[model samples]
Target: MTTELSVILAGGGTAGHVSPLLAIGDALRAAAPGVEITALGTADGLEARLVPAAGYRLETINKVPFPRRPNAAMFSFPFKFKAAIDQAKAILTEAKADAVVGVGGYVCTPVYLAANKLGIPVFIHEANARAGLANKLGARKAAGIGVAYASSGLAGARVVGMPMRKSIAAMDTAALRPAARAALGLDEHTPVLVVTGGSSGAASINRAVSASLPAIAEAGVQVLHITGAGKGITDASGALLAGAGYRQVEYVDGMQNAYAAADLIVARSGAGTVCELAVAGVPSVLVPLPIGNGEQKLNAADLVGAGGAVLIDDAGFTPEYFATEVLPLLANAPALAAMSAAARAQGRNDAAEAMAAMVLEGTKQQSTGRHPKMGS
Candidate 1:
């Protein structure tokens, strides 16, 4: 049975949604040479730039965000939503898709519904521990669902973990450590701490860490702080902090080096970062962003509960707390090693492959000529 498979991956809005979509696309292409993969996103989302940049054909639909409150937008929601669904249906019809794999975002809901209506199988990947609204809706009719965390609360969702990009999924920390350290101008013996709040940096983490820089330096550990673009914070030298193993860059082209050189990580618990840290076997102190639906808190729960990382409230993650909690943790070699081991144990390195298999299995079922309707 050499039926060619065409899969449409629907997700966008942020890196959390788009990253996994790209990962699965990469997996499908690698695992099956002839598979046709297309991405469904909105022009307003990060996916507009990222999806095409990743070398996948991106078919955009209107951004049809669900109205949370009763208002004018809510009243017009039906017409706009139907238009988006029609757009998605057109793309699927042209691609002749066998299945849809939705990662969840503003664009995913319409695509999922359209695929279901067309009798095409739909699979889902819920990246956050707390499932997003689009994914929650998509899961009801998804032929199979893969969740990043066990606590995602999606019925019939299997814990297939977060689908990471190839570089991260294949990284060997020990092998990359020396070069990573050298590139950062760090000494081999000095422990390194990497701080980041994703690509856009977090103000709270930046302020706390910047204020505690001297104290952090006093602990005999080096630091690689990614301050994010436009954060406007600098070092004692009035630069972006480059002095004696305490380097701060607005961004790094590749995070492989950062992860390779890190003995401990101080960052927000975004689903992507959490999964990357676990896969790389890096210990972390997670200070979840205190906003939205507390998804960041949930994102850190698996690693925190497994003793792989520590969770701190954002309000309490001050310079004082860093001095008391982080500095001491840095000095403890055994604890760091144990935490690294635990993180590795929780890592699902083969998540992309697993998710790819699920997608293919759903496609295979679709080929059986008797498509089982997903939901009653």
Candidate 2:
């Protein structure tokens, strides 16, 4: 007899956490049409906007907990964590969830505890090469940990590549370009440089790009810049292109088109974005955000070491250096091609399917009260 499955997919705060959630959700839906899936996230994170958009019920929790950092939020954690867990536990009971999948967001704190308390299995997926604090904590109890990198620290962890979005995964280099370029109004003769500061935008990267706009434009290249929502950067006044042909968008809704249109990419080296770039195989200059645990730098270092990308120290990311580093490669097609091949080699196109299989097997095991196959 076939068993039906229900799940609590939990994570948020950033695109890194939320994109994979949707990827896996799509996979699960495709694999098991009758499977019931519910998402748990704070109202504050991108998940608030994305989960429902993906056609799943996203239950809200207390504000996500910040880590060991000292602050008034930290001080109130004891109370908030308790309330969050209670709320999450109630949701799990209502969903009749067989397992809780944690994807490394502060919103996961309560979900982790609630799942364990109810004897529900926890399945965690860590996309970063290094485990985030939340995933590390949750991994200890999870029935299995799915990982994007071989080095991720989760017991029984399978080295599953990060799940990519359906839109991105469907793209083929040859066909994707023409369609994407036409939609963006870019001509084939114009070399395209895709610049982004992630979903939120980077002040430094934007400033540097703006400063070097003239030089970049002189390279006979057109720029597509996603300045982010709050950055308040715009080309409406026509300042960004200023004769240096360009398009400035506050946020990118269709990322596949952007990836397809660009000959080269310049952006932050967040683990999720890096995963996409690697799979897309676009030559890039990785500018890692320097802060927190240096995780972003570590993510960029992986690409640097793999010969897929070049890492630019944030401190040395001046407009002059940007022009110097890119001019040679931009002018040299062979170097760019090699980088693209290398980046593409690093992407595992099957990761999303692989992760969905794992979760499905995990749910089956829990339902049967028996050990599942190792691969499952």
Q: Between which residue pairs do clashes occur in model 2?
A: none
**Which candidate number would show the highest TM-score if scored against the true structure?**
2
Reference-based lDDT, each prediction:
0.87, 0.82
Q: What is the TM-score of each candidate against the true structure?
A: 0.90, 0.93
What's the lDDT of the predicted structure labeled candidate 1? 0.87
Highest lDDT scorer: 1
Q: Which residue ranges in model 1 land beyond 4 Å of their true spot?
A: 232-245, 368-376
User: Residue 292 of model 2: what lDDT?
Assistant: 66
lDDT of 1 by residue, 206-293 (tens): 8888888678767878877888866757656776655454677787666878899889999999999999999999999999999889
Scored against the true structure, residue 271 in model 1 reaches a CA lDDT of 96
Q: What TM-score does prediction 1 earn?
A: 0.90
